[model samples]
Target: MSRLRTPASPAYLRVVRASAWYDLAVTAGFATPWTYALVHDALSSCGNALGLGALPELDLWQILFANLMGSVVVVWAVLRIVGPLPEHGLFDGIARALFATWQAYALAHGVSQLLWLFFGVEVTFGVLQLVPWRRGGNACRARMRNADHRSTGRSLT
Candidate 1:
């Protein structure tokens, strides 16, 4: 059977393209600073909370090293936003950033009682993103199928 072509509205296509750009900019902008601040603040607070006398004296080198390690998260967040991943979807981008942030936190802080909080948040967001939502998978599959069918049909005709 000959396939019918459905015309896409220019406005819709523009919106879709714009969404990817926007997601890249917004996710990277927010995730980088937020991760940095959260990691630094949490560590500083934890030191005080543990009654470590003069929390500022709790090894400046270790604190700097941990913060530097945690900054690796910004790289992942940027990659998730601007790399090959589909950027039009905000949820996946956010999930990726969250996971990266948590992973960085875990790596910087090492396995400890407090690290569980970061791990839990990261795992929850990561798992939620992996879940199949209504029409989500279908839309992706349909696009791929359409492309494949078009390429094959062109060759045949």
Candidate 2:
């Protein structure tokens, strides 16, 4: 006698998709505010330490460039998630570079010693998240391919 197995239903898939989106949203919500606070506090402290006043009066061009850079980062992040490229593509590298730069800037500007602890944790997490793609990333690609095939009603074999 053969045992019958039931495939996941549409409702189940819906729940899974919803959960994934919810998780991503929550992560972003937390990350954005944390990042903003970290950068703002760091920059503010740096300016203060340098005797540059309460807030550094960046030129309009500088502010524009910073905004443009941030926009590029957001686009890169979205593409990294949606593109066929590995999750740890250029975006991860960019994130690592940004984190390193920020750390160096903070140190150079004499940011609060306490802030370094939070910076370290942020950098650590950023670096670790990129590891899955850096080491044996093909495994992840293969899994993604399998999922795609399954979703498209194609046989993995």
Candidate 3:
């Protein structure tokens, strides 16, 4: 079947939906504590919430820097959702993998049991994003190949 269609097509919409979920998660869930840590001198609780071992006292500048990092994630998510770049999925996958890896490291070191939840979600969603993109890309490529075959009466294969 032809993969060519408008953005409203099921496959394209699926990608957009997944991207939206990821962006929302980052914007709402991940950025909240960082914003709070910046607004208040509560870095310790933020660190604890992430299952990180006791964090050293954060200076005012450090808190600001942490919030800045959070802001970056928010901005990146927004841009990718609006633009919907093909490479965005790969970058998101990498980011989720890194988060999962860090959580696993923390769990192994006995940093906190709470990390397991984060780890599970990160790994699952990260892989889930990869699957849809792969399938979509494959379908598009197959359509292109079939088109070419029809035009030339010869298979590209």
Candidate 4:
């Protein structure tokens, strides 16, 4: 049996791009202290409004980590936004799985309930991107087989 597989479906790739947009929009504020202050206040207000615990005050070390994470995620988001390839989704899906794991760990360790919202989105997009959705699976296999035959100077049919 041929080992190669078809690329992700167009619909799935769209979902991947959508997830990247969400990441960029949400994390962009954390990329800088100036913007993070605004985002932090907003998140705190939101959490308080919802009766969820607010994020704690961050020291320099915490701020540095937040800035690093935000910068990395923002760059990753731009990559998918520009290219939106099937492979991008696969890698992004894996990253989301890791992020979701860490998020869950934080929630269990008495982190803010606001994290639940992000956790939900992470799980959703992660699963969507992780699913195997080859474009016309059998057709792709047949096409590949035909190509192989053509290379060998033979006809598959």
All candidates' TM-scores? 0.37, 0.41, 0.54, 0.80
Estimate, for each residue in 23-52, the C-alpha lDDT of model 1 and write its tens digit: 443333333444434545656588558653
Which regions of candidate 4 are displaced past 4 Å?
Answer: 1-7, 133-157
Clashes of 3: 0
Q: Which regions of candidate 1 fall more than 4 Å away from where they truly are?
A: 1-44, 47-72, 78-110, 133-136, 144-157
Q: Could you tell me the TM-score of candidate 4?
A: 0.80
Q: Per-residue lDDT for 37-146 in model 4, tens only?
A: 78888998899999998889867887788889999999999999998876677788889999999999999999999999999999998877765434334554565678
Q: Candidates 2 and 3: which is better by lDDT?
A: 3
RMSD of 1: 10.0
Clashing pairs in 1: none
Candidates sorted on lDDT, descending: 4, 3, 2, 1
What TM-score does model 3 achieve against the real structure? 0.54
lDDT of candidate 2 over 1-157, digit per residue (tens): 0110111223322322332333243234323444444555566777568665444444556455545555555554455445324433324544655766787797688654554644665465444444434544465567778989999999977
Ranking by TM-score: 4, 3, 2, 1
Q: What is the lDDT of residue 99 in candidate 2?
A: 66
Better of 1 and 2 by TM-score: 2
In order, the Cα lDDT scores of the candidates are: 0.45, 0.48, 0.59, 0.82
Taking the tens digit of each residue's C-alpha lDDT, what string does model 3 give over 5-116? 4322455545645655665664443355555454334434655766654445656675566566567777777766677644565567678888788788877877645456
* RMSD list, candidates in order: 10.0, 10.7, 7.4, 6.8
Top TM-score model? 4
Residue 28 in candidate 4, Cα distance off native in Å: 0.6
